[model samples]
Target: MLPIQPSPRRKAIAAWFQDRLAWDSVREFIAHKTVPVHSGTIWYAFGGITLFLFVIQVVTGILLLVYYRPTPSEAYESVQFIVTRVAFGWLIRSIHIWSANLLILSAFVHMISVAFLHAYRKPRELVWLSGIVLLALALGFGFSGYLLPWNTISFFATKVGTDMATFIPWMGSTVGRYLRGGDAVGGATLTRFFGFHVAVLPALTSLFLLFHLGLVQKFGISTPPWVEKRSRGAGTRPPQMPFFPDFFLHELMVWYGALALLGILAAVFPWELGQKADAFASAPAGIRPEWYFLAPFYTLKLIPGHVAGMEGEVVGLLGFGLLAFWWAALPFWGARPDGTVRSKLVTGGAVAFLAYLSTFSLLGYLR
Candidate 1:
């Protein structure tokens, strides 16, 4: 004997919304939208902005690919064609570049905010770990894209970058060789990078993002800084707003705003293609990396040279390996009984170091 369900009128209305219109969930959630006290600040906006920029990158990257030729000979010319002939091509490329910068910026801000507020503790640790992985991949995305223009800067930069890897104690040369796909940075290197920049990395990023977002939802928003003592009723509840309508409306606004900002940047200062990469050309002046890379560049700069028989390069390489190892093992390491305050302090210290290095780099640039 089954219990009687709702009246047919009520069932029809529910079906109409759940099946046809997608607004039913939004309505239900809004009826329960008791705003969290801690989430009403500007810091919360950055995560939304980060997601919006990623969407822009995907769309603009796909558009650029439509005109891009990944071969050695045709690559430069195809990019030139995009610059000159394609409709709003400069705008699209500019948006791609600017959005990438914005994405990195927002992600860093979001991470720092989460760290300061102890949002990465306990159940939320996986989300934080996933974010760190995403950050590394984002850097790789920039590294791979940097070489695509095949210009003097990109060429020398790639050489310097790969050479840095080769400075590792045991596996450096092997890794460098694998990256180059040959004796030096040649056509094969370009082709490999093209696949990495446009394909492999993007696919991985998409997959991780699905898990990252799902984990975030599962854990719910990290309570804002002010919520010192969370009781059962203090945190966000399960019947939250549907991501499709209520949340997505905000997402849509952010996306449009980011696009407009990118448009203005493109119109003001379109990206320039530097001299075509010559294996023999002299290095260009001010050989700084893209903005996002300044932190690592600074890290490599900051580490003191020569520890115990090892050269500065070796020490730096070892330090990088340790950092990456820690990042990979963080889920397990976090499982240990370290206090939340200690974790926050460690994260803060690393961020501060990066900030110090970045400031120095900018001053060096200005000088």
Candidate 2:
């Protein structure tokens, strides 16, 4: 066999790249003052757990794509083929679904923990905002993916979801029409959503993840509420450790634990496809979104019917208006060290409302 070797110029370029990557400056930048001073709280693990599960979802989703189809006629059959014929395909699909659920759940817990601890203040505002974006995009992924199954429940759910978009005012109907690719959900809508679920959103998510982690390393992880003064005195140097081998090692362990938990869930309750889509069939009893969406679904249901001149949909438009206002105001609201009394009130009300909604959803499931 002929010798395999790079040209001298190529070898020189490779060495330069390696040397740049291994530079002490980059190491110092990433490690900064990060320390292994562990608090040993399981709650701290949630962020890493969420990141790990998102990676897993991406991998397993790619595997499933090998056999899955997005077209109306072929979608259900393709999924069935993956589940029943492909080697360990069921396991891959189950893992993808379970990991997605865990990712969202852990992100929620992490966000709440960060909020209560006031970790979103000042230097960490962007980090928190990036996390909020991630959460929103993750939910978008769920919504788009839900329609890909093309089953009866998914069909109606998509119909209801897109129809709600039409409530947005003058632009609402236009956007809804564009999203549905016409007056109704059909072939073009499926194609657009499938592309977004598998491609566009994931690409944006990766960019946001980079920005979030960069901000994290730039500003040290926020300490818990109970821990103050990081050391003996305000001016005294705090005990510290390296990020490469110590703090990140803990993240690895936490990631492993999250994977184990996801494994158990997938094994226990692998996702089942509902009946093949009947375009003319009546909507199923008790149609509900995935768990992460139940709170929003309940919110839409609970909103009073009159706002502005419109009745049935005006309330929804106003609710969405409020949501946009909140997102726009987050950076300013999070700038205050105290997180504002009004912010507290709003967050508290949200938490309470979600809890109540979740309880009801569980009850419905039980019944």
Candidate 3:
């Protein structure tokens, strides 16, 4: 016997949804969209890569949350049981951890590529700013989730990180207390971080992501300066491929590759739980924040005790503040007829900053 099909009533409801949703308009938009083919085509996929990792984080995080406990006393114990007892729990947790790191990494590369391609000119400024916000949220996710396991390393690292916030110019102490929920990292801090990690950050991220994509759809993808200049000289538009099948199919291939890598990493080096946090006990030596935080962490550690009568941490914090301000204001800086940064100095400075980041991060890890 053949399987029963949907009743007339169900078919009518489905047709109503299709009409209400305006599937025809969506199809029209996709039909008109095209992806540019050039040397820069590969860089276009970095956005898709970041998005893929984000979806992975969402799925795995929900699974982990089903078994996780937020209180200090039970947080570590719950995670321990999930990994050791629950079916495929270790793999889910490991994938979450590894993909979170990769998400940030992919976002960084995507932003840097945008900068090099000068994609932030004029109309794309909001896109760049939105992306910067997303990067900050990704870091926030890392910081908040670090404290979730309530492990020894995470405990001390949060203390150090929150302590650094105290160097903020005006609301230093207030901010530190706000982040930790008290004088130090404790039960309150665990609960606060867990709330931000699972609830607050995700909500903000979703809104910003929607706005960013809406702007991208409105403005369309940017062509690099060189590519645009060449096309103009040739008196012809650049080659284009259909967005639906061509570009999206390429994205699927990259996603498959990333998924394979995540599986291998999850299997080969499963995430491990360190000793449970002890607020009163001594923290182990060499405790450090996550890798992204290392450069600033070691910068503070290496600063002189006093710089022109100012506290080292204060000085370091001010210097980093200036650096961050410059990065944030990039969209408005060096505006021209074409609104692109043509200064060699700007490029040199970016290269120098990357070098500084790499050197200090390596030193921090080694120390």
Candidate 4:
């Protein structure tokens, strides 16, 4: 049988794009790349899921921005208008809020999966560091965006959060001033946080995300130690599936599932637009920051006001700083000089950390 050939117009168009874009190289790369297939492979989807949620966040955020006024005088009213007046605006805002929460949750899962799978060992150190930075930026997005509505709860929560910043020793006051754009949370703080949520954080996250993805591409997927050891013991190679169709299609399905969950949450329980912030009013009792920040927030609450002549808040902040340093530098201490991971120690630490976060977050939410 004779083969079908492209028409002259189609051929010309293809040639034009191939000349300008050189997309063939990308196709070639995709065709050749493969993902290691194993029990832990499913965990890799969380990274893609996080990215998907981020894209959702950007789209919904842009839609909300059309009607959002950054000034405290108008912020609450503007949000009210979006939820009540604009068509499906409530759903859009809800999805944005829910997706932001899910994005952080997915990032945490991805990080924990990496730790458990020992994917951060050796040459992938930069990847792990970049991921940590990206996660931090995700948290920054949450903290900054939480106050955009300028509601009473958010107002007081941000006030407490910025106050905690003042416990950072040398740079605490500076950071607090920078974040508030003054000594207190007010119109300036709302405007400043708006800039951060929309502009500063997105820019930083984009850079770190690109770096992390590039490193992942360069190193390919890491096979867990157990997987590799099993293959070696059995005298067989670890199996893999082509990235183009097999793994990519699986990832697409997972993204669809996430979208479905997001829609259900947004539709069933729309995000609240609380009362407008009254700067003169007393702070509400039991007001707290978002769930992600609840762990440390609750911990700080339990500490005595003064600890051994130092402010308890300061002591808590210092302890958190040390723990953060240890977590971020996991690649350094996690693996031994002989290129073997301290799997038991790392696993134990991760379990303990997760327990602390979950328990404190629940307590903070309840009390």
Candidate 5:
């Protein structure tokens, strides 16, 4: 057979794509990428780990969408059908829940590691800010998703979380109403949360992720303080491993291990559909928000009825808000590439925060 000749349209289309994509440059960039080698390098995996879990969430979430109905009247029934009737629907839902939790956990670890390493110093400030933004979005995903099934716990939890907004300084009630799409956590609230969990939060997160990853690739991973000092003294940069094959394989191993763990957790504690939510019924006693929010919720519960002439809830809300702002702004503290606050001070602050959270959470559980 004679050799086929390309049509003019095909030739033009291929040329257009070639001009737009720059596939060769992308391949070259990937091939040249390197991950720094150091004793603390393994901590880097948590960032990638969080990213992988998010991918799992997106995939499993889409599958569950096939069976998930957002309406309050049908939400619980739809979830029940997925668990009991749909093929492997139970597995998919379980994976989604488990991965969501793990994704949050991984993000937390990555943030703490970055803080300790002072990775947010100097040129990478925006990377740290973007990462923090992504972390908040991940929490948003959890908060919104928890209410999707319209179960008893989720119903109460959403109510309690939304109530916090009512304590804000000026726009409290307005923001709270906007969140619920009305005044209460009813069908409107459920629908609003469903839209946020699947569409709004994901869209925001995706945009932030691209910004975050672009900066990470631009600046490269931050080397640990000790390693950097030692390398500087020795007049050389730290050794690096190729990001393409060697480092990528190690990341895959970490991901596989994480997946195995998530599978075990899901299989052992498959998500409960819980009692169908009844908005008219009183919220059950001892009801609390998800584990991530437990620390904050408990702190608010422990605050006295009033603080400094302000309503206790409002005072607590402002306090928490300030604390969050301070933590998020840590990178802008004029810290050098290697140092921010004194090491002991940072360590002590972290310890105190952990102790406070633990004590409050335990008391919350006991109470």
Candidate 6:
């Protein structure tokens, strides 16, 4: 058979795009990029999975926004209309809620994997910082979107969450007012949160996500310390695979699996709209924030009204702040001066932190 060649018209179209978009450089970068191959390589897919879920969130959120009204009077009704009236609206809403939850879960897993692999050491510090910021933004997205349905549970939960913000010492009241848009979770609070969920948070997330991805590309994937040591002892470099087809295709498969899981969950257990929020009604019993916040929520509940002459909530908030700072600064403390990881110490800290979160969150749910 004769060799096939591009038709003149197809060649012209390709040349036109090449001339205008200059995408050749991007292709060149992809062609040259490689990822380390090891047992830990599978952990890299979680980052891509988190990114996939974020894209899912943006798509579903826009679909819901077309019919959603942001005001207190209309918010619940708007959601009800979406699920009840629009075609497949119920599925879309359910997917959005489920994907939001999974996005947070995936982000946490990615962060933990990075920690365990010591991927945050040395030049990748900024990458780690950017990732931590992105995770915080993901949580922000969840918190802001939680109240958009304007249900009884969400309203009380937001009130409780905002009230908790008021224990941050000097800026507590100001931050609380800012979050609530005044004194309480009312009409203005709803509007503010809606704006944040749709606009502000997304914008910030995009910027940070771009920075994070850029750093990842610049640094390339990091092999675990033990893997590098083993490679050195063997007098051979670690094995690697092309990032384009090999890793990218595997990541796509993982995304498809995630999509399948999401569809099954959404179909089997569609998210409930619950009762319309009544600000005057006594809060329904057992009001609590979503699972992501449950650990801190339950911890706060256990604290007495006072601790060592300071408000217990204030003390708890300060403790949380310190813990967050410590975790975020892991890239510094996790490594020794000689560019080696303090493996035992870092692993112990991670285990303890995981234990605390899991134990408290489970107890919070059960109680």
Q: Candidate 4's error at 2, in angstroms?
A: 9.2
The sequence of per-residue lDDT tens digits that candidate 5 reaches over residues 200-238 is: 999999999999999998988887667877899999988
lDDT scores of the candidates, listed in order = 0.75, 0.77, 0.89, 0.94, 0.87, 0.93
Residue runs of model 5 more than 4 Å from their true location after superposition:
1-20, 334-342
4 versus 5: better TM-score goes to? 4
Per-residue CA lDDT of candidate 2, range 263-315, in tens? 88888888998888877789888788787666556666766776556675667
Please, what are the lDDT tens digits per residue for candidate 4 over residues 121-185? 99999999999999999998999999999999999989988988988889999999998999999
Shift in Å, residue 110, candidate 3: 0.8
Which residue pairs collide in model 5, if any? none
What is the model-wide C-alpha lDDT for candidate 4? 0.94
> Which regions of candidate 4 deviate over 4 angstroms?
1-8
What's the CA RMSD of model 5 in angstroms? 4.7
What are the clash counts of all predictions, listed in order? 0, 1, 0, 0, 0, 0
List the pairs of residues colliding in candidate 1: none
Q: Candidate 3 on 86-105: residue-level lDDT in tens? A: 99999999999999988988
Off by over 4 Å in 6: 1-4
Candidate 3 colliding pairs? none
- lDDT (Cα, tens digit) per residue for candidate 6, span 1-367: 9999999999999899999999899899999899998988999999999999999999999999999999999999999999999999999999999999999999999999999999999989999999999999999899889999999998988898898898887898999999999998999999999999999999999999999999998889999999899999999998889999989999999999999999999999999999999999998888777899999989988999999999898889898899989999999999987789999988999999899999999999989
Summed over model 5, clashes come to 0
Off by over 4 Å in 1: 1-35, 230-252, 298-307, 323-340, 343-351
